[model samples]
Target: MQKFFAVVAFAAAFLTAWTAAPDRAEAAASRIKDLAAIEGVRENQLIGYGLVVGLNGTGDSLNNAPFTKQSLQAMMERMGVNTRGANMRTANVAAVMVTANLPPFATQGTRVDVNVSALGDAKSLQGGTLLVTPLLGADGEAYAIAQGALSVGGFVAKGDAASITRGVPTAARIANGALVEREIAFKLGTMSTVRLALRNPDFTTSRRIAMAINDLLGAPAAEPIAPSTVRLSLPPKFNGNIVDLITDIEQLAVEPDLPAKVVIDEATGIIVMGQDVRVSTVAIAQGNLTVTVTEQPEVSQPNPLSQGETVVVPRTQVTVNDDSKKKLAVVKSTVSLRELVDGLNALGVGPRDLITILQAIKAAGALQAEIEVM
Candidate 1:
């Protein structure tokens, strides 16, 4: 109850501040690096199939998981163990898939974190150590070698009729486990033009970026080839030091124009609104209806003079609450996100209730923003 009150208080304070917010759309400037990234500068996904060894009798069963048995046989033969006809039955191994993100320009011998998830019905991977496995790229070529002790941060315990589990025990990670053996060489600075890709594509943002760059360099070197990409050519003055030009371009600050948006996470009852969210004068009515049912069992016995036997009686109680006195409150036109939040809060609306009200306002063509449910 105390926590609930605290949340309500926090929401009230947040709304008060939101309704009194300044006009940030005209003055605030965002760094170029935060808004754009150089094209071809991204991470590559690397995955490999490997087997995790050294389990404490909680690994996959041979009879139930044939793939684990086959993988174990293949691994044993590579280590000079001839078991072509031997019936091997061991519960100390698990087949797993190793995954890692190869950061761009990763050099040889540098280690990357690797994630190992069980591909079979392994009871747990808490104490397992991944065997020396070659991590491959999409082209089926080995790019890195991963091998280390797994760090499964959870455990499993079972008892007679009940069991308690915390986190997932079948997935684990190894810090700095995979050694990089390949590199993707990307040519920058030498190209005639570099593309600046905006993380969020907007025409106004693209035009602003181009104009900002043109003003910064005193020339029209930056052009908006597309809403998301800004084409920048090498100026003759900066050809001798193209790296310096790139450095300067990334440091310029420009005021980015963003569309008004509201994001609501229904599962968590979290509501997020952009600074520009506004709503026209509206009225909202909110209430809740709760229904409850209760079951009660009673025992009845026959009197001393009666011929009735003892029996059990079942009883149930149902109650319903109808909130028909919901009051409709008037909300004035709210221009800023703070005002909108404050107005909604005035109606005594929680996150879930606010979601419904905002949707209704949008349907009525009063909400001047996009509503996204997540």
Candidate 2:
């Protein structure tokens, strides 16, 4: 009877241990659109120097910004007014720098929004109009031209000895203010092969992606060139147009490897940990120490006949409180993420406390992944 009781106890322990282990399928997750990226698609930045007119006496002062004066002089010359070396003071115009992004494969005559910022000491750009300005590319070539009325989302009001200014005083934007004049040269169908670059490169993820592509379209269709790049042969049908091929390839699903990582935002005290994070058996003790100082003022009056001066004295009181006698919590080796979270949560640690704990864990060679703080 004693042997049978011992055997039953052992069996129960074994079953409990087996059930405690986390299921691999439930823990395994492939981030949505995490490993996929478009081939040969990108955005180009376009910039231009322009002027914003129609300001209500809040334009750039010509004395401070000489560039604004020079620009205005040059613009006046084009209109048959030769103002060379002329000291002109105008409060209706403000110098602005215009910027816009040209999307990939943007056709001619397509309109895009442009951002305008005051480059001088303009108090406000409200109700200003941006003149015709030629937008230039990185290669010093004109790509688009911007011209529209400014839509400053702010206002300023002034009265005698008082003024109220609200919103941004230097920046504004114009909707559909730029027109594309040229197309970026990008050949997508000329090559018989194309490369797919992963947004986040992982060896395991790259292998899985290559395998999935090969399985979908035989082994001869796709090959893994490196851990981050996969080369694919263009099918005869897609050789004429590559857009359809990209659309189909991006929809293919593949299981991705979860990276062990811990991210902390120091500004907001946010801590994020991956599911694969594990912790070794360690003891953690947390306590608070506070020191407070207070001051009390006292006044002493002069005696009536002693000719003594009145004086004020300040008294400071200081106190220190330490809570180091709290119980130290011990956590055993955690094999899974849920266990690690549960153990940490049981210690009543907040986000800031968790950040410290993670840093300490990483320093002790227990955390297996990279720690990033932003």
Candidate No. with top TM-score: 1
Global Cα RMSD, each model: 2.8, 9.4
Candidate 2 per-residue C-alpha lDDT over 1-374 given as tens digits, one digit per residue, 9 for 90 to 100:
35433533464455456447687454344532456665677789999999888998899999998899999999989998999877788988889999999998899999989999999998999889999999999998999999998888778888999998888867898899999999998887566777778887777787777787777656566777777777777777655666666666666767777688888886666666676777777787777788999999799998799899999989899999997785788767766665666666667666667778889888988777789998
lDDT of each: 0.85, 0.79
For 183-204, candidate 1 gives per-residue lDDT tens digits of 8787665777888999999888
CA deviation > 4 Å runs, candidate 1: 1-12, 15-28, 158-163, 289-301, 309-320
User: What's the TM for model 1?
Assistant: 0.89
What is the lDDT for 249 in model 1?
80
Superposed by TM-score, candidate 2 places the C-alpha of residue 160 at a distance from the truth, in angstroms, of: 4.7
Indicate the residue-level lDDT of 219 in model 2.
50
